[model samples]
Target chain A: MSCRIGMDVGGTNVVTGLFDSEGRLLRRSKVRTIKLSSCELIQQLAGQCKEILAAEGVRESELEAVGIGLPGFIQSESGVVSSANLPFNDVPVATRLQQLLGVPVAVENDVKMVVYGEYLHGAGKGYSHVLGLTIGTGMASAWVSDGRLHEGAGGLAGEIGHISFPDISYMCGCGMKGCLETVASTAGIARQARDGLKAGWVGLLAERFPPEIRDELTSHDVWQAYLDGDAFAGQVFQRTANWLSRVLVPSIALLSPDVIIVGGGVAAAGDIFFDSLRSYVSASLHPLYRERLRIVPPSLGDDGGLYGSAEFALKSRKIGLRI
Target chain B: MSCRIGMDVGGTNVVTGLFDSEGRLLRRSKVRTIKLSSCELIQQLAGQCKEILAAEGVRESELEAVGIGLPGFIQSESGVVSSANLPFNDVPVATRLQQLLGVPVAVENDVKMVVYGEYLHGAGKGYSHVLGLTIGTGMASAWVSDGRLHEGAGGLAGEIGHISFPDISYMCGCGMKGCLETVASTAGIARQARDGLKAGWVGLLAERFPPEIRDELTSHDVWQAYLDGDAFAGQVFQRTANWLSRVLVPSIALLSPDVIIVGGGVAAAGDIFFDSLRSYVSASLHPLYRERLRIVPPSLGDDGGLYGSAEFALKSRKIGLRI
Candidate 1:
């Protein structure tokens, strides 16, 4: 039986999955990501893939291809990755991995892979145009149309996180001021709450987390506080939703996507976040667009990128044969 | 010789162009668009198509298809047009025209057609992903990827004119406040200049046009005054360029098209407009994106939609036959 391996390479860990020809996950494995040179990191990823196949009782010759989802700027056409999260700087990942495994390989941006997985099996199924927004430690988006990713000319598409928001003074890690991600991401929400606490805003956060631990606050704590009826925490999520709508409104007006998939850690905040985002975006959009567009939470959870990468490998192999 | 006819149907007039199989324009004709019912308007369009073919000495049987570019909502799959500019309200434009001419017919948004034209034979040639911005009386955009228009699921993809701008209170015709078109478009520029004049700001506009004809102030007059060293007129264009950047920056970050073709009446403002817009956008975009993207002026001039619609009809005929 032909099988494929899909790897989700992140800053802290690398998760690899074994998938059958039909895209069903058979087994999974994880390894810590250590700071290493580009060559060493590629070898580590290659080792993980081999171990997953061996442990699943599959021979190396039985493998069809491997797909990897990595963070940062991925030029899939060139198989190069340039991202701050990983020790990759214009690294030709696909070529290196294919050499190590002696099989075909495909690589894409992690968020894009997540969106693709959703497009194939989750909230985006049957949709022609999908705009996927991932609000994690940072905010980014990806677009999928007709089963193919719209990677733009230079593969820098879907960087809505870096778009400058009006009247915002926060400095983004991108070296730009007022980027949407500076105030809309998981880190952004936590930062907002921390700023409020430092400014001496009296709220549940100060009464509970206290001054010493204020610096250690996470978006989860603020969300929990909001759930517990904290007014200040409520405003943080509300403002994030509003800033998020600024990005979505233009996206809706420009793309008219069938579905806007809100995924990542921020999405885990659930109804409190989604309800306000949906209502704000709907109210801001023209009735023509509002009536047809669906904004929904992702369903596949963490394995979306794995599923997407495996499926992408199978599809890429088919395309390779055709060419 | 086999040929196609493309019609650009606008509120003021209808311009039709006959093209040979190779997509070269062979003949052109125009007629005023008067108020008429949907049925009457369809009949009028048919008459215009027939007249254009007859004038070019091309028999009806020699025509392959007819394509029309119209303002407002176009559901090309169903051949229906629901536009506010013309009498077409869910009218089956393609079906009616095909019936009258006994040839295949296609309909698309006017802006999409213009973008398609540019992609095929103008500044957007040799590029895979193209984003076209049309800043006329109102602002709008269209995208073409690999020679196919990204029409979105609901066929309302390129309505950027309706996206609200922060801090602007001017009401848009779309019933939204602070729409980008409220200040970035040709009409919007004139409106700002008029507002400045009406508020008793000192400038050449008041000294020349005076209060009586102030209501009749046009973008052309403002451009001319700016060229002649009117600080108020200069500020109007400068601010308009700034607002235009707000739309372009997000578009760049999200779409990352190889080329952004700036077209329509406002492009006529020349360097005084494009120079400022380009610099602001270039400064704002990350070097990764800025290096590969080209922000260019439209090359097809007034006939972009005409060329695009004709080419689209020919392509549609091929698709129709394959199905």
Candidate 2:
């Protein structure tokens, strides 16, 4: 009757899963994130966990542990989270959650949790060294080598989004000019289309989205135009791929990972995006590094964090209020 | 009576060192590299090793192992080398040298060897995760995490030289345009000065070296001018620092090493170059990453590879003809 609860807390939503002893999902639930204080958010998350467990007819004593994946600067050892999107600034999430749930809880950066999930159960299942890149509202990456994650000294490793792209003059949100995030993220892709529309290179984007609604146009609109064979949209994706390749070239040279698991919203673009990314990266890499390197999308999809957190909680036997 | 021979084979010179059981340097020797064939080159390296051992009065039986650091693509498992500057094209260096010296031999890439050297005994001592950047003829980097090297899947991790700089139009030796090596290396710095001279911005360089012999201008000449308050030379160094910072920004973001050990010819520029690099990198990095990051010069200087190679050989047991 032993069970575990895995939770993924994001800006808009909180997803929780009830997994049985064998690591199989027994039940799942989703609720809108409460943007109140840290204490209130933890209370809401606890309620969601209890609701999911009850739906599966599981007893509170049968719940062995709970694991969470949070977005932002997460200090794994301290379980402290400081995120721009969440109301967590130096908030000790694991301590509060454990106190409420009466079970041990483990916390990790959402991106890293996704990577661990992929490495353990997805596209990176058999790869000895895996680099997972999450290209969504923001750019983030995580690495798992020899079954252990490398969080660097500050636990801020894989923050490649801030890498400068000298050719770019756009101001990044990080107060730096020309950061890779200025163009590599999903928001960056939409901004590219908007910039083009304003600069008169409109093409199908202007015809479809129009200037009145341009500010609200998403990366999906740009991708739609590219699928419709719009040259300008194609150019935008091409530029994104090239700039991404510039970053990947260094990554490949530095890590030489066997497989690069690319997840997040970008995976929805399918082969068109994958082909462009693979070719651009391959063309720039040395023959020595180009051999045996595979770049693929994650097989776990949105459930990566759920599985990753459940597995992480199950594996970490000595979890307590470390903070 | 236990001793070891450490050899570093470069394009211009072959350096060898004899180390006692306690890893202390007992004697050293240097000779010009033989660029005839792989066989002759291996023979030359073998002779250098033997000469150093004889000078130290260490017999073949007393010499526990011989280790060589070669410049180029090296397969540690296979002990094969392929380099641009050397005559080694898939050469079985460890096997050939072990046969000639009647002792176990270990071979590694020159840059990685230097990094391992620094990690074990120099700037990287006491640091758990260390990143070593060698900026000489070309730019290369290596990482040591948890006291073990991350060689990637292809054993070619840390090849940041070829990472593209989209702003520059210069073609790299690797057939890519605007690689980091195009501007971050000593040769690249000299090339920048020469290109400026050709474009009619010949400041102190023209006054000092003159156009008649400007074709032979080296990074040393550029550094000399910068030391004498030359505005143009200062700009060249600043540009190099900025470009190098662009690369390091990504490196810091991805690796988050406690210390970045900068070595090779660029280290000779001292604080003038180091200060510029540190400031630029700090300016771009997020405060989260900027904290506790130290950029330092290697303490072992030219002897890093020697110590690293000897330590590598002594540590690697069951050595045989790996190739």
Candidate 1 structure quality by residue, lDDT tens digits, A130-231: 999899887888899888878887778888888775578898898878788888999999999999888887868889878877888999999999998898
* TM-score versus the correct structure, for each prediction: 0.95, 0.90
Best TM-score among the predictions, by candidate number: 1
Question: What lDDT tens digits, residue by residue, belong to model 2 across residues B1-323?
Answer: 89997888889898898999999989888888755777888888888877877777778789888878877988878888888999988888888888998888888888888888899999999988899988889888888898776778868787888877557788999887878888888988899999888888756788877779988999999999889878888888788878878668777887789899988886678877888899999877777788777999999989999988888877664433342
Return the lDDT, model 1, position B179.
79
Report backbone clashes per prediction.
Answer: 0, 2
True contacts kept of each: 0.69, 0.70
Model 1: chain A TM-score against the true structure: 0.96
lDDT of 2 at B311: 81
List the lowest-lDDT window of 10 residues for candidate 1 chain A: A314-323
Candidate 2: lDDT of B159? 86
